[model samples]
Target: MEYQYKEVRRELAARADTVIWLDHPFATVMTRLVRRTVRRRAGRVELWNGNQESSLWSVFTDPEHILRWGWKSYGRNRARVRALVGQVVVVRLSGQGQVERWLTGPLAAVGEERAR
Candidate 1:
């Protein structure tokens, strides 16, 4: 599940057997955030509660803009997820390569096991 607060994640993790953490780099995260925001804004897509993305310029003027918020929270989020390593089973995928491998390897194995 997507959660912004550490307390919320911690609570959720307590009941979860495995937590998949996409520990991507800052550059990758920002790039994807910008791309998604631009696509949503350009397409006038409706987000949760009828909220649509604001002007891209809002990245500079709006402190609470999604892009800005993502940039500010990236490091803190990583640290929080890292702290969960020993508390629960966390499959931290750092790069796209690792993610691809995990999907085809370990995750696929689990799927096979469940199908048995």
Candidate 2:
């Protein structure tokens, strides 16, 4: 959605009044990904298409490993979202607390405006 469908993304953003960017820290994100992966693998959680998390060793070996992807793309994703600053009304929420605040505050205001 970010690189391939430029026109479609632009149209979607233009149609929407605001975009919320969750710009969590790299360490925070990586930690969460690691923990989630561990939990999923331990539980053998089934996901879409009946897929399950692979061995923990695959984290270092597999090219398509989600943890690896997250580590590699975190900075790029942040930059990509930041680049949308001038293109849309971006509300960047840094952490869970900020997101909760947004859900209760500015987001409510947007709903109220829509109601008006």
Candidate 3:
């Protein structure tokens, strides 16, 4: 469930028992975005609606380019997720290490619970 609007996310969070927020740093987000976009472009992957990644140069020229969009929305997204902390159970993972730990610990427990 990837949501762009804060209102939608808030509504979804209200229904979910827990919401995992990846609070990665801007640099980390940009690096991953670059790698993903390059890989998609090189592989000629077809994204939704038969759309493929635009030229890498578009990052500089296109304000709506995925990379630029990610960069521009990062702060607002962070703030939106932060505001949901008390309203819902938010497990914010700030780094890869935290993410891995949650996967093996809390998340695994939830999975195991469902299996029983």
What TM-score, to 2 decimals, does candidate 2 have?
0.78
- Model 1 regions more than 4 Å off: 112-116
The residue-by-residue lDDT of candidate 3 on 1-116, one tens digit each, is 66566557657776877778888888899999999999999999999999999998988899899988998899988887787778778888998899888889856988999999
Residue 17 lDDT (model 1) = 77
Clashes in each model (backbone N, CA, C under 3 Å)? 0, 0, 0
lDDT of 2 by residue, 12-87 (tens): 7667666788878788899999999999999999977999988889987998798888888888777766777887
Best by lDDT: 1
Report the error of model 3 at residue 37, Å. 0.2
Better of 1 and 2 by TM-score: 1
Models 1 onward score TM values of 0.86, 0.78, 0.86
Per-residue lDDT over 1-116 for candidate 1, one digit per residue giving the tens place of the 0 to 100 score: 87567557767877877779998889999999999989999999999899999999988899999998998999888887787788878888999999999889856988989999
Query: What pairs collide in candidate 1?
Result: none
lDDT of 1 at 107: 66
**Candidate 3 lDDT score relative to the true structure:** 0.85
